[model samples]
Target: MKRREAREKAIQTLFQLENTELSVDEAITYITEEPTNSFYELLVRGTVQNQEAIDNTLTGSLENWSLDRLPKIERTVLRLAVFELLYNEDVPDRVVLNEAIELCKTFGDEKSGRFVNGVLSKLTKK
Candidate 1:
């Protein structure tokens, strides 16, 4: 699968893991039959492993909103993007930001894209 697809799957997996007690493997299996995409696995596992630090990084970038207060889709998108920004040096910051916005647009409400962009733009600037 493409990185975009992997990111989408990762977001879904992370979203599930956050709301339920599913393990990483269970989340992956639930999301896809061909779970062999290394990039996808890396995204889910890496994000889960580094979530506290990711959340900490996010805490500063949020303007008036706390991480816990954001909608689940937005929160998951931010966490996935933050994980890529901090851990995956292979992808550019712009790509991560754009992908995050796209994820929000796809999975969240009308305002989700701009909300994610606003938050991620601050992180990219810093």
Candidate 2:
């Protein structure tokens, strides 16, 4: 799958993992009918493995809003984006940010894009 598609799938898988008791493998299997690409697995696993650190980073970057208070989609999008920002050195920061905002627009509410942009902008600056 393309990177964008992988990202969307990663978000969905992560969403499922958060809301349910599914293991990473189970979540991945539940989300896709076919095999997943390396990038997709990297995202879902990396985000899960590094979640505490990612959430700490997010907690620091977030404004008045705490991490848990945000909607699930928004939180999931941020976690996926932040994981990429922290771990994927090959991808450009601008691309990660733009893609994340777009994902928010597609999967989250109207303001989700802007909210992601604001949080990620802070991360990029540091």
Query: Which numbered prediction scores highest in TM-score against the true structure?
Result: 2
For model 2 the TM-score comes to 0.98
Overall local distance difference test of candidate 1: 0.91
List ranges where model 2 is wrong by over 4 Å.
none
lDDT score of residue 113 within candidate 1: 89
lDDT tens string, model 2, 16-43?
9999998999999999989889999999
Q: In order, what lDDT does every prediction score?
A: 0.91, 0.95
RMSD of each: 0.9, 0.6
lDDT per residue for candidate 1 within 1-126, as digits (tens), equals: 999999999998899999899999998999898845999999999999999999999999998899879999999999999999999999999999889988988899769989989888999899
